[model samples]
Target: GDPRLQHISQSIRVVPHFPKNGIMFQDITTLLLDHKAFKDTVDIFVDRYRDMHISVVAGIEARGFVFGSSVALGIGAKFVPLRKPRKLPGEVIYEKYSLEYGTDCLEMHVGAVQTGERAIVIDDLVATGGTLSAGIRLLERAGAEVVECACVIGVPEVKGRCKLLGKPLYVLVEPRQVDQCF
Candidate 1:
């Protein structure tokens, strides 16, 4: 059997009516406050791909940076950022996708991932998988082989798993609902 990953699964707080009503946001600040939890979260990815030849760790913007940077550092790999439009400097490659509310675009430096390098995309959570999918496409277009995609949390109700069908996905925690607590 695959190693049980429940220990790293944490119950995070949910702030109801956040940014808008009827939307309960999964707050990861609680998990960030715990050092052991943070380390374990990073360890989950490091342990899984320790032997793989990962040249870059591509982290989705904002929350992804937190976990991705640390994992990249731990594994002695370079960290690349997948950011929202206009956030990154220099020549950037862009991909547009629809969000739950509206459409948005993600940008990355043209040369962030070198040709033929292996990368692991990291993010804090996977919801509909739109952003993650865009990230994968962007990396592939730049000639990077996406070895895997990993996240700290995954919300299956939104068809997140289906969006990542062809990729190896590793999540530290798989929660039924975004609002569900540990």
Candidate 2:
């Protein structure tokens, strides 16, 4: 693992039972608060991708935007947002996927990614990998070659990477559960 990733991992706040019970949510809001960690997190990604000759950076809605946009800017590529249903205000295409409990969907605007363009998907975390899978499908449907999927953190126990259909995944950290004090 990258040594800088250790610093990145240490900054994350793990909240037990977030939005539900028996779930250890790796919260990145704390990482965002530390200036050096935040910059390092983005820098690590930018450095890896800067020489890849990527054409587009497609970010999963919400958290992905935080890193993907900056990465795109760094690499001089266009930023594409894969959003939740009805969030994009244009002629959009969508892909529906299964979640652990129910179903969710991701949308991308038409023409956002040109056919045969080299693209990468970005998200903050990968839990079940369903979300990243959907993003990959959407890009493929748009005729883009998804170079890879990148996230800040990964939950190893769940094996989220298994659901990615063989697309390479890059994660900065795999956080271990720390006992909750509060």
RMSD in order of candidates: 2.9, 2.2
How accurate locally, in lDDT, is each candidate? 0.80, 0.86
| lDDT of candidate 2 over 1-182, digit per residue (tens) | 46877777888888888878988878788888889889999999899898988999999989999989989998899999999999989999899999887899999999998899999999998877889999999999999999889998887753334336778888777754983422
Local distance difference test, candidate 2: 0.86
On lDDT, the leading prediction is 2
**Model 2 CA deviation exceeding 4 Å by range:** 157-163, 179-182
| CA deviation > 4 Å runs, candidate 1 | 1-7, 157-165, 176-182
The digit string of per-residue lDDT tens for model 1 on 1-182 reads 23434444544556777878876666677778877777777886788766798989999989999999999988888999999999887999999988987999989999778899999999988878888898898999999999889888876553233437378777666652455454
Report how far residue 16 has shifted in candidate 1, in Å: 2.4
Clashes found in each candidate (C-alpha, N, C closer than 3 A): 1, 0
Best by TM-score: 2
Ten contiguous residues with the weakest lDDT in model 2: 157-166
